[model samples]
Target: MKKSLLLLIAFSLMVMGTQVQAAGQDIRLVVDISGSMNRTDPNNLRIPTANMLADLLPDGSEAGVWTFAREVNMLVKHGLVNDAWRDQVQEEAEKINSVGLYTHIDHAIETVTWDADWDVDKDRHLILLSDGLVDLSQADTQEERSRENQASRDHLLRERLPQLVDAGYTLHTLALSDEADQDLMATLAQRSGGLHAIAYEADDLMPLLLQILNRVVDSEQVPLEGNEFSIDPLINEFTALVFHQPDAEMVLHSPSGESYTRESDQSNLNWHGNARYTLVTVKEPEAGDWQIETPAHPDNRITVVSDLKLHTSSFPATVYRGFPDKEQTLKAWFTEEGQRIDRREFLRLLDAQMQHHQDDLLLTEKNMPFAEDNLDFRASLTDFDELGEQQVTVLVDGHTFQRQVTHSFNVQDVVAANLQLPENGGTPKIVLRAQHPQLDPDQVDFQVTANGEAQPIDYRGDGEWQVDLANLEPGREYLLEVEAEGKLKGERLNLVLPSMRLEEGSVRALDRQPEEPQETEESQQTPPDFVPNIAPQVIPSPVLPTPSASQTEEASEEEQQPAQSEEESDPPVDDETADEEGLFEMDFSPIKSWDDPRMLWVYVALGLANILLFTLAFILYRRFIRRRKERHDAQVHDDEDTPEIDDLEFDLDDELDPGK
Candidate 1:
């Protein structure tokens, strides 16, 4: 009875877990198709950076592409990610690289985020390749400029960028020019925890890609069985991780038994659906063949299919069990056909379990279907659709906060609210029923409340759902009561709670509101008016000595008197909107913003200096290279005319004279 009770309790918690579609660290590489990445990335040999990325990805490491010239374009037709997706990516990338279009970095980012159906959980990897400054020529006035700046900032921040932040896919910004957005790149890296690389030319690409791609998923492997009947690891898309060499060549076999090795002879191979067999060739031959020969082991052999992975590539049937697990070790790598599968010794399950335990990103390899029978599933919130209506934005400390959604459903179906009592327990039984316009209020299913109050919220038009909180105290207990068609469906939707957070703007506004008391009538009264003579006073001249406190006070009063008289003589201008025009930048309200033409000259002067410096460097480099080439050529010609010298040659007096 105790064992059965414990099993029931263990099963309960698993049912209670929420099925939220959390973010993943899937990466999308936005390559610069500006006809430049095609010109060999000098860092990664002659291979283009695009191709390098394609090669570097591990099997099942999901990747997407966004190529940009003047406009941003997605490589795939939709969201299909497989080996065949490469052709589309390569084609678009090639077009982008070779085409000549004005580079607009801001536009590219905006297009991808707005048009390409950005995945919140996946890391956004954007590569901008234009070699120029961000053109904000559209902003001509102060107002326009402010709006432009706001648009630029909002273009990236318009959506709550949680998916990017949590996934740690900061932009791995690779720039071909020194003029790339270094600050923006740094911001993206800092926010998303990605890398930033600057390649001034194509030659500096291969090394960069190689450096990043060195980390293969599950690079370490060990044998489970002996040198004969062995087991090893091989990762593919879905179906073919077989027992072979620790790093074996994956090949496809036809039903007739014809085999073809993987095009890329790498251990971490990308999986395709065409593979039919896992062929493990042996280093040493003739040992296992003789043992299983003829009638000795016709029925003793067993066939098992094993396609284990350390990544998220979804191919069919490669993940689940096919063979008897690797725990039962044998002397050699043997196939179920009784054929000696060679080149490996062993395969173990302990290591596979270890890998599984370590992989926190992917919970499990199998896309296990949800079973409502054995598990507890709930929908606290449902039918989340945003319409263009009264969208009330809440602010906290001057910062915009997430909008809270209140939803109400008609009780067409009755469900049981299996709410558990808190530690300092209160009520034992609770039930909730819902009624909508289409359903009868009398025949409602369940009632949900923030507190223990019987008064439930009602649904209003335009998606307005109301719930009474009279019983709710700040940070207190509540229960979601449910009852469906007189019989409760399940306690799946009861554990709902509110997520309340203060906006930064609200906090700031609270801080900025004045806390001082208003001025009183007596305090508001001005200082007594002092009448003073404007004309220079003619008085008795006296010998000046260091003045005493009273004398100094009188002198200061006399000095201030003239300033007061001048202020009274010329009353201050009351116009608050006017400023004395000066020789500097000026914005004429809604119309014009003009910087003194002298500022243009300042830039011209800077440009001239840059030109001079560039010319000087170019000339110096040419001279040095030219002189070095001349010396090399002269040396080569002189070497051709000279006789060869060897260490074995004797330096006789006769030989020395001839050289002289």
Candidate 2:
């Protein structure tokens, strides 16, 4: 029993080790297809570089390809790396044409970061290639447009990049040209715990890509143990020193002789570890030799973390790509060193030319609201129908932040085939319309099958084809299978029409009909009379008396007297006779008061008061005007009489006297 137990334990350990080794890494290659890439890389070596990288990747690894120009496109989705997949990827890479108009780095990164299938338990990496900074130029002048474009790209990078880093995804960047934003690329790589490389020409790209891939795939830890050892780091490069034994006391001396013990609080050093191991990360290490000393344990091991270091896992990766007409949302939460920063101003959208095009501005609904919380600022984009590149700019604390994006307006081919029935109850037919750019009308052929039997179709000119369904039964569902072939190779299309019900009264239409109300036997039966179960009305105890005939007659008489008096007091005037006598003139009798028999006197007094006020205003206005004129004349007279400061006295008199 003891021997059997030992064998079982050993088997279990072997299985666990196999499982750990089987966990694979996910790597995505993101390439730039912008117009600038075509200019910078005249040899068009990106495709070959990508193919070479694919060849170098280890078998059974997960890898994918994504490209960005004015927009992002996933040529090969993430899948297991095998011989077939590598060949397929190579073919797709060969098809990549440098026809895109803009460099949308943010969109490309976001696409891989968000859209790709990322396995968190396994290692994840994003290899980015770009020839230049994000270009969103819509400006007339190159200088202004470039400035705006950089600002927009910077804003987007700052806002969306931290999410990738925070998610634990390492980003490796390859700068493809001299104009590439080296600082930004390096910053992105460092923040994401990755590496950045620069390629001055097309020749340097493939080798660099291969080197990075090899480092990631074949990374091995080098053990170090000694009293004194030298460590050198590249200038402005991130370096890390890891001690395997947590209890080991170590002292590190910088090139400047600055000594740092394990407990030293150095600004550039970020320390984190446990009992098993301790790690120290130095940002932008000094470009000189450094020394380490550990007196505690002879068994202590030191590991160097440099550009060749590989990460096992990274942050969730995603990328966004779509047509220009669709709305895109960009979100970012502002924070500094884990503290929220609420100093953002506003976010704006620019066209491909990097100009302030009002038509391309983000929709009001997509605007990011300024708030003090840690919630993300979101902007909705719309009306970016201009083909090629666009940009989103966010203003943070008076600094311009920007991101370049691309879009396409290409519409895919659509096959519109539907069943139509005659309104007069004749043969049902299938109507077909092919909406494809490359479809040749003469070469287009279609076959229809219903209920596992072939159906006859009549070809009509002008790209219209139809199939008769007279043999099919009416008011019954039938399955339809349609096969269509276009002129281009591999342009075949197959469509299975939904089960459709035929009608005897008319031909069945493709559009769905509303369900008619059903009449059941119970509903058809007559409804019983709705008898009232209400209680009887109650009678009042005291009833009011009805008016007598005399009282009613008196009320009628009183109402008639007013009408009679009004008629008797008023005189009847004929309108025609009154017009001749000028009796239609305006009347002032209504304004005549009871105390004053005539209102004419009041009107006369008002008219006099108005005249007096107007006379006074006019006199004052004239006097004011005269005084202003006199002041203007006086100033003019003074200006004319004033002598010039440069005039010299007696110079002309002296010259004239001498000449005479």
Candidate 3:
């Protein structure tokens, strides 16, 4: 009876779990076909890239492709990935041509997302590729056209982007040329937690798109080193991408030294060769090392479709030098499909290490310690002491198989927010001094909380914000978050301040009770007037160590200042708007249907042809009517000149005389 009851409970739990939808990736691809693409991508490399993407998509994932310019078109209708869907995509890719007049980016996005459904269990991703700024054809002045374009961009960012974020969409954007709007593309990626890349030339599009795809989708890949990659027994299938020159020969060598080429007739191997790249998919690939005999290319890759794979956590794009809390902690483990592999015997032979590098210099290499449960390995990333772009690769080397993943991040200066606990009993203030001169003081926002409840903040001039902590029960902690916009060089930047923690009575200098009158006034602060300000000061940071009361007092005195009145603290709304005007760069040179000299001449020629056609038609109609009237008059005159019945009597008499 006990065994039967256990089985019954397990079945009930499984049934309950089935009520939730399974997690799957739904990807939408949006491409631009504007007229500018004629110069940007004259060879139409996007077609081959799209085909490769369709073939490489996983079996259970759903995807669709769209092409847009003045109008949005569904090139490949959204559907589940299957052989039929892929064939249809291949057929439809040929229809993409560079004949569109305008680039209506907002309309394309709206059309793609208007009727789409969202599910909590699925991750929806939109990959947008473009090569030019937002241009809409209109008959207006250059400045007016620019304003309209800005308005369209603003609407897309302010309204549609938030909806996508709320619906859990990762929007990866690609800017294809120097003329493309890099800021907007970067902002979309940052806001949506997606990857963004810029392609300086058309040739770079394929490699960059592949990079974005690999990041967005957690597909397992075997590391290709020196044009060779090893495949283990657990891998059911694998796809290899090889790039080559036009005149060079490409070949694939199998584990048993069997050579395969484009002409090889094998039921298990599907070879797709192109002018620039060859994509090969193998079913039930043989175990052992395989080699692609082609010229060395950086973009050569191999991804696998398998049940057993290595799963790892994603790393941040940026980390601070002195902030330990913001440090990336890598947690990785092996899995059979989606279930965790927890067998000790299986995990014992596996080794995982993270190799860090800056440019060509090797910084450090460390191993991830296994957990007690033998399920996952973790290690704190502590090698970010230097500034600049850094690359880290996680390599998992097992007895028979190997897997690796690499990503890059930037190390920046420590941006701190310090909470000044008053030496004498009063309201605690948070001070953040401006570290960069271009930091905008007016464009700031704060998300502050006290003991899990929303706490109001009063913005005082000079980078100080006052918060009330009088009602704290002496042991609870609070959280504060600050976000601001600033400028770097000549370009605008979105600055995300680190979240700071404040514990009650932890850093107080003395055991003093709060003053009653000041406490009452601080508690009564309103929410609307709690604006934020930016300045150069240190706030609480993970690198901060607990200091004595005197140390805290000294830091507070150096940073703190007298609070300003509400009128003086609030920024002028007009000046803020003026400063932000012309954020979107619009090119008026492309708007030239009526402005182009050649088009003007074409219009004049068409107008003259219409006038000549009308005159010829009128002349022909008048001649036809005149001819008909002349024929009628000739028949009437003949009837009038001839004799009638009165002359019949004379005719009869003449006939009788002729008979006699």
Best-matching candidate per TM-score = 3
Residue 307, candidate 3: alpha-carbon lDDT: 79
Candidate 1 root-mean-square deviation in Å = 30.7
Clashing residue pair totals per candidate (backbone < 3 A): 74, 35, 9
Per-model TM values vs. the true structure: 0.30, 0.31, 0.59
Model 2: per-residue Cα lDDT over 313-412, one tens digit each: 1111111122222354544443334455444442222211111121235423233553335344445555433321122333222122222212112111
TM-score for predicted model 1 compared with the true structure: 0.30
At residue 158, give the lDDT of candidate 3.
69
- Which of 2 and 3 is ahead in lDDT? 3
Every candidate's lDDT: 0.32, 0.50, 0.65
lDDT of 2: 0.50
Could you tell me how far off, in angstroms, the CA of residue 12 lies in candidate 3 after the best superposition? 15
Per the 3 Å backbone cut-off, how many clashing residue pairs does candidate 2 have?
Answer: 35
| Residues 109-173 of candidate 3: C-alpha lDDT, one tens digit per residue | 88887644555567788899987556563523334545566667667766888788888888888
